[model samples]
Target: MGDASVVEKIYDLVVIGAGWYGLGSAKAYIQLHPNEKILVLEAENSCGGTWSKDRLYPGLKSNNLWGSYEFPDFPMEEKVYGVSEGQHIPAATLHRYLTDFAKNFGIFERTLFQTKVDSVEATANDEWALNVTSNTSTIQRIQTKKLIVATGLTSQPNMPSYPGEESFVPPFFHAKEFCNRADTVQTCKKATVVGAGKSAFDVAYAFATEGDAQVDLIIRPTGQGPVWICPPYVTPLKRKMEELLSTRALTFMSPCPWQGEDGFSMAHSFLHRTGVGRFIVNNFWNQISSEVVETHGYNDDPEVFKLKPWNSAMWTGSGVGIHNYQTNFFDLVKEGKIRVHLADIVKLDQNTIHLNNGEAFETEVLICATGWKKTSEGLKFKNFSSGLSYTTSDIKRLSKEADKKVHEMFPILKDQPVLRGPVKAEEPLRNYRFIVPSGAVFKRNIAYAGMVSTVCTSIFSTVQGLWISAFLDGKLQRAPKTEDEVTKEIMLHTQFEKWRYPCGYGASLPDFAFDSIPYVDLLVNDLGLKNHRKSSPILELLEAYKPKDYLGLGEEWVEAYGNQ
Candidate 1:
């Protein structure tokens, strides 16, 4: 822990979490206000939130390729990082790149690692009082004029409780802790993994290939089925998957309500509004889905066919994953090395797992690849003036109104996929532009980044960092000025997420895949900056947008609007 006097001092800005969003936000703010005192608090020992040293396990690779995963200002050079453009970046390489990004931008000097924020309250003096504790057991109070919560969605793991897990457990844990228990991959004879997400598949694959273990992958019959896993390349042209999703022309094919601002209002309307255009858009998505399914040979065996996604690629948000493994992941399953079970765990008893479908499995290790908790779970947020925590009412009424508006604006969203099982109801977040809470728009002292889930997180985090900095600096010309306007805006976006990504985390935060570019366009426009980064209209539509296109955005904003 630092000195007691240091904790007593107040700062111009304080950022929580040292991940991609936190580092990006701090760098952007400091660029605009060079002399301001800024501090970043991270719970982990090092940077790179999800890719931190504590989380990397064997066989873990990024869904993103080399070019699409890097920050715009600091390119991950092929020579420097030893990674090529088409290859999926390894976890170690990404961690090294993020650490270097922090050091290069001076964010490392401003950050305090292993400091966990216990609670945060709004002070009467219009500041934020953060009560934090370090790993050394030292507690202190730190205050800041502005706060940005960039903890993101992956901080806390969601470990479900089973009936007899306490007594029957033999090395049972969540996948996030795989780094610590990595020896289990080589030692375990048999392993059982729960859930069907990316993490589950990665864990099962590691056990099946790295060791002599027989892996059992359990996909709950009541939960969302297997996710759509696409190859690295797609389409008849064999374009990179991430590149295809990032291209404006391909993104425009998705029924996004905000794509009209791309200077193709007529084309957007014709594609999403007319019957013939809808057929073309639907056919495009269907073809992409069919190609992926056929490439994987899911139909070769009945058990392998069960791995096919329950929802269409168009309706599935971030649930769609990339097949970035070195070898064919399905080959092991076909060879009886990995078995898939479509049943829920009934109980665990002494290295045995009883299923709801009258089946019992004996395994030496049990790894739960279950998802994460809500981003706002750990910290307590309180409103300064009211002396009460912020809460929302009439969400149902607002959702109805917003749903009607979305259907009227984009009729294509009305045709939603039929979801299996009961989805746990999630309260829509009330943050304006998914950054500042609707009530805090006037305060402008608190904001959030990386709370929104998207495939193009590099671009989103960079643009969101600029938006939050400008809004905190009071330079945004298009921010909502009135409370009612901000509330309505937040409500509409929240409801649009519900309709756009019903199968993913849309109900809690902004979640999308291909629609990330248009979402960034909205933020760019709000900052009074040009959304188009390319020179020609043809290139702008066809060429994929990478971090390079958004390079030096903070400098551009300051140059255009002056760093007042």
Candidate 2:
């Protein structure tokens, strides 16, 4: 009787993409909710999702330290993680660690490798029709009550469409293509880098330090902020302690006893803006300014170039300025070792870049350092969507046309818990469809690595995507029984700026200090967190709360192997 309990090929939950968030949620959910029939589907062979694919980059390293960068359940191997040149662990080492974590957590057993998801459609029964396409000859259709999308934004690389882009006489490619440093060097001698973003800097730095390749990068106007004193991506504990004390003192001494904004505090604004992507930041960004640096294109935008208080929420990332790391790229350019052009790219002829400003560059290699876009247009989810398709036009059209406000196709009841400008007494339909949040409830299937919640913007493509599956398990919720209801939720959320997204802008940082309280006591005290969730949020509900013996430290887990 016990062996037949799980005979159904169909599952209660299906997690797409076995990446960091997917794996993390799998471990967490399995530990927290036993007996839940959950299976993870991965498209690639071998694990470590992104890391497994990018073994070509010879000396890749993370920007953050091994200590702060680790997941709560898994810590990096101490011997392999200690820094010599300021990085926590080598990319390859971290990849191995992730492999180990999966084994210990038992995530590998339920994963379907090399199996591509063909289609996912909802039935009249409120369940989902999931079509799985495998490299092998078998394609299976399974039913699941919930779906989790753990594929982060960088799943697809964005390639720019420059005129004559095809005319590039030399071979062209994105950073994702080159895995090893030797390949990076052999590809370009006088490399022309396009786009001045984090990836551009990362590519540049990789070429410079790892492969020793010289690069001439073309930079457009970065964000609109004053030249900040960007620092190196290194952490000196002494400096950190000083900054912490200063921040603490400033916080307490503020006129309103709140975390007030300070003038040109680079570190303060960095954590807010960098939350947009999956890349770990070096924190050196807050120490540099763009004024001293030079790049291609219009350096206009008074708002980004000008200084502002640290209103990370009000800025909506639009207020952000060019990060400090890119400015450092100029130092290489000014040495006449690498060149920078200010003209716009007009055309591309075989091996030559035509600029509108009467400039042309002949090249053997061209690197489009442009960032990736977050739409699923090219993705094969078409067959899987089962009639679910939301083009950018569809979202805009629905927002303009819808009169009645419904959450996920269900009619909003009286006294619906509407949030921001999502559900109104009048028109609804304005949210970005990727999220597909709650219809009439205050919450949605949204939450990131405990960072972004539904408040900022429910990132349907990242870890926040998994929360959607989590919500699906609880059919107990009354709102959102159909697809139309889901559409209504999207349209309604589009009314306000995305700063309201959980784990996005304006979302208060968690009080890492109060974690010392036991889960039972914390539930009773019921701080502001309780207003949004039960006791310690997911930690309390899932019984994953870490009991702390001191401020900001959980001694229980630390002492698990004590007495040695």
- Please list the C-alpha lDDT of all candidates, in the order they appear: 0.85, 0.42
Q: Summarize candidate 1's per-residue lDDT along 1-564 as a digit string, tens digits.
A: 222224434899999999999988988888888898888899898899999998999988899998899899999999999999688999998899999999998898888888889888988877899988886435488889999999988988999899998898689999999999999999998999998898999999999988869999999877778988889898779998888888999887877767766767888888888999888989988988889889998877887887988877887787678998878889888888999999989899998999998999899999999989866477776654321123445666777888899998788899888878887786766687888876578888988898888889899889999999999878896877677777677778888888888778777677878888888888899888889999999899999999899997887888889745
Query: Once superposed on the true structure, which residue ranges of model 1 sit more than 4 Å away at CA?
Result: 1-8, 136-139, 384-393
What is the Cα-based lDDT of residue 431 in candidate 1?
80
- Candidate 2's error at 211, in angstroms? 4.0
Residue pairs clashing, model 1: 168-350
Candidate 2 lDDT: 0.42
Q: Write the per-residue lDDT of candidate 2 for residues 109-227, one digit (tens) a residue.
A: 76777766766665655566777776642547767765665554455678867887655676677766656334756556656667554455556655665555666556542221121
Off by over 4 Å in 2: 1-8, 55-59, 80-86, 180-182, 209-212, 221-229, 232-330, 378-436, 439-564
RMSD of 2: 11.8
